[model samples]
Target chain A: MHLTSVLVIGATVIALLVLAVYVIAVRTPEGKLDHVGGMRLVLWLGAIFPTVVLTALLLWALPAMRPLPHQSGDLRIQVQGEQFWWRLRYEDGNGPGVISANEVRVPVGRTVVFDVTATDVVHSFWIPGLGGKMDMIPGRINRLVVKADKPGIFRGVCAEFCGLSHALMAFDVIAMEPSAFDAWLASARGVPARADGRGAELFSANGCGACHTVKGTPHTAMIGPDLTRLGERRSLAAGTLPPTLESTAAFIRNASRFKPGARMPAYSAMPIEDATEIARWLRSADGEAGR
Target chain B: MNRDPLKWHERLRVSLWTLIVPPAVWAGHFLFSYLWASISCAKVGSFARFPTLFVAGTVVALAIILVSGWIAWKQQRMTGDPPPHESGTQIDRLRFIAKSTLLLAGLSFVAVLFSALPVAFLSDCR
Candidate 1:
């Protein structure tokens, strides 16, 4: 058994026995026994003893926790919790780093320290398969170090109850072998492929460039998510919808239909054919440039 | 400290030191240490601040507990002791209450110390 379990169970049993004795002794004939001496014994054994033991335990635990305030890891991932989605940035030691939204790709067998903060309300960042959750509070950064023992897809979510769309706020984390992760990162940094010029024109004509971004294109804005690799993402609308042509178009037309309180305004006024072409064009470049 | 005659019981009587001081000290330590550590961390961004605050809190809390314990001892000396047979009488009541409070204070002192222990072990404010 773990030392903590043994100590806790042992203490509980001893306390229960002491309580039984105290109850039984108190019920005895009044003045039949010396009160001061027995009460002193109770105070000594039941009160003082436990206090001393707990103090010792706490002393041990204190040192164990001391390293947290100072320790850090090699790989850093800055994750900012926004209104309902996550903004992920992978920083390569002292580098400007690459930015993505709603998804993170990390390498297996390496410690990735998360610099967690919030752009708006307080939220919690949790990758249950990786480790414990850390709060993402506005104006404050919390560091949480996590490592994946093996390659796998891990789901991350906002654990805090922040808003109406809190439960719907989620992300996907893909953990790859070291070399594969490196290769993916290399490709992820390249310019997005420009395939359908007509669709791109339609996207720009509707003012989509004001919020979303497509790398290597004229559509560059910081308000919403970067859509350079939108087609490649596993989910849309912050994990509210699967990455399908129809789903992407639906999300683009009206994100609130899938995720209530989504920040992106609906494009329902745009022509249906234009919206479909744009969604198709965007998703068609998902794995472009072999990213 | 004694302002109102009607609120006499709330006054810091040497007689009731064991009853009041330990819990008061414990609560004070908990609140003050947390507040101090938070403010210090926000301003300093230093890793060493929390442990220092907690260590100081433990020392101060222990001092308060010891003082209360001393008062209990003195009260015991004057009142003789908790009676072996007597259930009523001012001396008996005072002794009983004093002993009870001393025990509670001792336990509370340990609890207050325990509350500060986690900051010593934890590595981050996050």
Candidate 2:
């Protein structure tokens, strides 16, 4: 059974016992016990009983308080908390780190250590189902070690109250089998295949390359999130919208409409057809080929 | 070594201020434990492997509280007129203070143990 279930059951039993004692005390006739008798009762029931119970409980829970043991060879993921998004880099000692955004993937049953920090302000990294929350403070790295017992997708959110649009900040946590995770990581490290079309032309024409990076192309500057594997991500704009053609186009055109105080400039003047074409190019499988 | 109950009670000289001793020890232990944990984390990046100093501090605090409680318990058992102890006699006053101190000592003993619990469990700052 889960630890929470055990705790809840224990608490319920204790509450029922306390209630029974209360009923017995209330039903007793007046003057049935003298002051000395009452004192003895309080000494035994209130003082000694609680001390023994609490001591036993403390001993029982002591071993469980220790965190999962980690070694230097374990996979380390560096997560930096920005104003409205998360920057992730996975280092597994195989090759150069794989940089991604707004999502986290870990191997099931393997210990994953997160070296979490912040760039601008204080943010807390929380995935409630997996482990405890760790504060991401600027300039200081806080470590969170976790081992996913099962393979599934979970949701993680910024627990701290960052600036405007903080409520919109969230990410997906994907736990996969070890072999699949290795395959994904190997594929994620290679450069993406080049995309060429009217949408690709418009993407360059709009100067999107100045901020975002798409590997295997000349758009190497990374002021914004890397768009190499944009097509594979489950959500858009740091989980603000679905990864659909229209939603991506709308977000590209007027990002501030969906998220207030977004850093991306509002391209309201750009033609709707042009935005849709760029979104299509980005969402195409060939556009996300290698990374 | 006097066998006279009244003389022995007077010799001990229990006072109203003695009531604060047990809880004060608890509070001191509580503060020291937190400070030790914080300093250890900040300096060494984790709690000490053995934590001998923390263990020693806890032992001393528990010993002082136990001694206090033992004294109060002995005083509480002294023969006196029972409840509705409204009389202003010296013996009644001493007995009342002793009983209150004894209860507080019991509470403090439990609190000190609780404060020491986290150290026994967590080996790291996380």
Candidate 3:
């Protein structure tokens, strides 16, 4: 079915749920909002009826939404929800781990279990086309089961308001063939890390390591997402922009321009020469093979 | 209606339940998970802690709602000298608003708890 049709159907279901509530509300006594008076009839019908219906829906949707293995052999991925972004670390025990930010690539026709958590404030991990939403609550771990039935790109967003840049925080799920996905993962794991040249030297001297991490290097700080496999990621700028050398450079030069209230400081205080050098360094240093 | 001591006591009881249950259930959830994890780690199998916790939380939240309803019943009984105006209408409106908000919150919390069920139960089963 067309995606919009599925949406329409879902909308109809929600409308019915609301209608059920409204019917009960109207039958309720005229005076008080609290006491239903004769409205107990509505409450009984509305609340109880929907409870049964929603429960059925939950059961029906469960298999398609997050199918558990009736037997065995399901892929498991760790999905970490950070303030304003998603850290997708794909592990399969053979590769160096394909660490991508914002966009996640999964094989179609597979059930994937996501171990989700939040590094900062509470955020919800939701990809409507895949399945139900789960919160990324701090100090707690939440799990989501999702399936990518078709090979296509679907938009995913941080459904919970995290902070000033919450609305801008978004990601894409790229469903690919199992072979292609494995290839991508291997390539991402094998991508070599390079020195930032003049830019690389300046990046560290400029104190970017205080926040972001570049694995197998001195910048081991955990304040930000690991940038080890950034080059292979399809989008950058916290999923706000498509991953491109130029966009990545621009974002590094001035993160606040695209994401207002971004936690990362802009290179605004630095001179243009240094800023450009830093941006270049970032582009070069990103996706460099770990030493 | 003067400030009756009995009314004050009743209100206190209602407020105490309202203030207490939500947080208590939240704490219960954490405690159950920690214990479940510990036990599961030790290899002593049991029903998933999450589902059990979910059930417990739901029951507590439901109790809160029923008591709130009972408080409304009590208020109705004690409101001897109606407001000389449409007191029933006014009181009903207030009650509906309060109940609606509470029910909404309670239901949403339960929904989240339900998701945690599978995770909690399967922690050691694997």
Candidate 4:
């Protein structure tokens, strides 16, 4: 069983014991004890008994509170919380930092240190199943070191209230095997092969390059999230919708409809075909596409 | 009126100030623990591995509370009229205050120990 389950069960038993003691004390015969006798009873049961029990409990819980040990060679991932998205940068002692958005991937059974911070307002990075929440304050970096023992996809969200779309801000945490994760990270470092096509033309025509970045292309602006591996991301619009072709097109045309206060302006004037092409181009740059 | 069992100097020595000593030590320990943790995290990026200073502070607080409790225990055990202390004699009042201070000391001893528990467990700011 989980440590939390054991703690809850223990607490329930203690509470029930206390309740039983209270009931017994209240139901005891009145006038049976003198004032001195009553004072002795209170001193023993009320003061000494509780102090002893609490000290034992404190000792039992102290070991669990110890922080997990980490080393300098651990994989460091810097996660910067924006208004309604997560900007992720992976640094595995590799050449350059690999930037992604709205999704976090880690190697199972390995220490992953998240250097969490914020760009605008304060946010909190919380992956409830993995570790405790860490506040992401502007100009201050807070480190949240975690290790995923099992390989699976978990959902993480912004635990702190930041803006109108705070509830909509979420991310996917994918824990992969060490080999697969290493391969993915290595491939992510290389440029996508399919940066030119009809969809690419449409994406450039719409001036998306001025804000967003696509690796290996001249659109290297950092105003928005890097779409280098958007196609492989599990979710779109920060876990608001599935990363389907239609949803991507819809979001591209009218992002504000799904997430209020999003910085991406709605391209309501753009034709459906043009929006679809842009979305397609964005999704085609996965590492697999290059291979 | 019953003869004042406690002289004026003795009464002054066991004033309300004595009653508050235990809890005041507990409060000081609590504040000092948190401040120590905050400063350690800010300067060292984590709590010190040894934390000798924090341990010393806690030992001093616990020692003060223990001493206070011992004094109160001695005063409570002094010969006085038993049971219903309704006579409000000087001895009765002194014993009552002593008993109250003893209980407070017991409570504060545990409080200080509990406040220091976190230091023993958590080694980092997290």
Candidate 5:
């Protein structure tokens, strides 16, 4: 602890001892000691001392609580919260930048500015192991600054009670090395490869194109997550499913089975085989299928 | 609602208002200043012209605190008056309440001032 905290704690302890000695050890009604200093102690030490201590602590914490400057290596990303999802825009430092959903990427050892906001109900963006939560109020953008020292996939949850699927809404924070992050960004710009060509055709034909977007494809919609890099994600439906072919297929077929009250309509009528193919296609889209 | 005209409480409502006003002003100022600074600063990603908001808010809050303090001082001034109707203890209780409220006013004044200190050093609310 710092010297101020130590002094505060020490003063508090000494004050407690003095109070105990005065209140419990000394008899007040029987007049064991003088009463003149008693009122002075109560007024000065009891009341004013605490106020001074708290004020000092607040003063001490003020500087540390102030937001840090966005360093040269800082990454800027805008996170917009919806009822049950997060829309992300990574400031690629070039052009309008890379649009994404659910998953966020940042280089380890670099500060990240999450310019958080929401479209519908209020939501909060929180990465518990990383930093504090910032509210994403509708019509108001709140920024949360954080830094990660190690490269890992940290799970983030919506700390606000936004809607029915609030418990299911989540995202993944993938902190990678700067070189690896640049490579990932570069790959995200290109077309996603699919294990099955039929799945791409099915994805468009089923009207799923109206909500989701896959870059280099005709179907560009703003309602759903950008599927350009969906295959490269760690989880789907806001971390409700593992990034696997079976989970993808299952979620596409009947998302309500995994997460009841999910916003996506159930596609139970889709043929089991077609669902499996589409799931494989999405799984491949994660960019791991080629490896 | 069941207030009796003969009781000291009926006469003491003014003093109670005096006790309550400073903290209420403090709460309003605290919330407004933080939100105004946060929202305005957030929109532009900078603290440009934010010091004005801070200054205006702190000044308003300090003025309110001062006015309430003066009211509490008036209530305490009335503590010297002798009880009129077989009620010396009632006067003493009034004095006690007034003294306590004055002390609270002092503490809350300090709190209001302490809260404003952040606006001076912290340029942004991000």
Candidate 6:
């Protein structure tokens, strides 16, 4: 049976149960409402029967949901959900794995544990193809286990109704070959030069430091995405925008333009030359890590 | 219409829609978001919202509403009828059905449905 069909059938069963209670209610005697007998029967069936059934279902589901008792040696990824974007820090500790936004790539046929949390309002972490959904709440860490039976892209969204643009806040999961993943991670961590250019100058001149942070640089802001390796990420704007250079430039210049009510202010009204220069500087500064 | 015993469908309709729609919508929205996140991040986890409590509350409340409305509806239907209105025997029979059916079995089922819905749906038991 199709999965969705099961959901519908379950819902139908609930409806049927409710209907049964209503029918029983009409059978009660007039004026003298018995708090004990007639009501007790309906309440018991309505309440108790479902309790047992649901408890059984939950017991059945826990093992599949939790990590298997002997399961070990899996990969861990720290996934942080900010106001309107997703921040990823791989647990490798060797160096930063691809610091991309909205795009998650993992090796196929391995259990990946996602340590997820929200920096702002409650955001739910969900992936339909892999398993269920976990909430990313401030001050609370939720763990999600995902195993891609094969190499494919899975779609995910913020299950909680966050503030504005919540509908637009989405992401993707890419499961690929182990070698391909390692190669991508290597390229992602590669350092670029801190050459004297338009991007570097704007990095200091613009008020970008108030929200974003860059390691070993003057941009110490932690209110937004970490830019220590911004250029290395697959997607930009917390997965709201694609990872293309043009999209990154547009987001830097005017994030609200892409996602309305975005927290980031737009630099579109700034001098066109300045915007272009900043874009160019950031574009070149992509791989300047460890330089 | 058999005039021997009362019917409960009308009262149950109110319980079904009023108690069911709002929370069901909430669950639906949550489910949609989880599906989106899973696809985007390649991570699957249990949905963390307390939708079960909300749904259970709705069902329980609906049960209350159904009982109350059923009494009113039964009174209206049986008015001016031939049955003895003031006798305790009739009361006992009514109590038996409510105790046996609505309260015990019916309420229990609603609670069960509430908790089961999320997990069932989470597993794509849609």
Candidate number achieving the greatest TM-score relative to the actual structure: 2
Please give the lDDT score for candidate 2: 0.86
Q: Quote the lDDT for A2 in model 6.
A: 57
**Residue runs of model 2 more than 4 Å from their true location after superposition:** A40-53, A286-291, B1-16, B44-46, B86-92
TM-score of 1: 0.73
The TM-score obtained by chain A of candidate 1 when compared with the true chain A? 0.75
TM-scores for all predictions = 0.73, 0.88, 0.55, 0.85, 0.72, 0.55
**Selected candidate, larger lDDT, 1 vs 6:** 1
Assess candidate 5 and give its lDDT.
Answer: 0.77
By DockQ, rank the candidates, best first.
4, 2, 1, 5, 3, 6
Please write out the lDDT profile of model 6 over residues A59-159, one tens digit for every residue: 65554654422145566777887667788877555665545456677788777888799887899888888778888989977777777778888877888
Steric clash pairs (candidate 1):
A62-B120, A62-B121, A65-B121, A65-B122, A66-B121, A68-B123, A68-B124, A69-B123, A69-B124, A232-A286
Better by DockQ, candidate 4 or 2: 4
RMSD of each: 6.9, 3.3, 10.3, 3.7, 7.2, 12.8
Cα lDDT of model 5 by residue, A1-291, tens digit = 665688888789987888886677556656654555666778787788778878877887778667767764457899999878999988857545788999998888878888999998999999986787899999988878888889999989999998778899999999899889888877776676655588778887788888888776787999988877777787878888877777787788897777776677889999887887766655566657522
How would you encode candidate 2's per-residue C-alpha lDDT over A1-291 as one tens digit per residue? 566887898799889989998998899999998887997898887878878977877787777668888999999999999878898899999899999889899999999999999998999999987888889999999999999999999899999999888889888899999999999999999976655788788989999999888777778776778777788888887878887889988999998899898788999999999999988887775454222
The residue-by-residue lDDT of candidate 1 on A148-215, one tens digit each, is: 88899999999999888999999999999989988877777777666866788888898999988888
Q: Superposing every Cα of model 6 onto the true structure, what RMSD results?
A: 12.8
lDDT of model 6, residue A43: 54
Which of 1 and 3 is the better model by TM-score?
1
- Which CAPRI level is candidate 2? medium
Give the range where candidate 4 chain A is weakest over 10 consecutive residues by summed lDDT.
A282-291
Mark the regions of model 3 whose C-alpha exceeds 4 Å error after superposition: A1-67, A70-73, A95-98, A193-196, A215-218, A244-246, A284-291, B1-126
* Model 1 interface CAPRI class: medium
In model 4, residue pairs whose N, Cα or C atoms come closer than 3 Å (at least 3 residues apart or on different chains), thus clashing, are none
**Least well predicted 10-residue stretch by lDDT in candidate 2 chain A:** A282-291
- Model 4, position A158, has a per-residue lDDT of 100
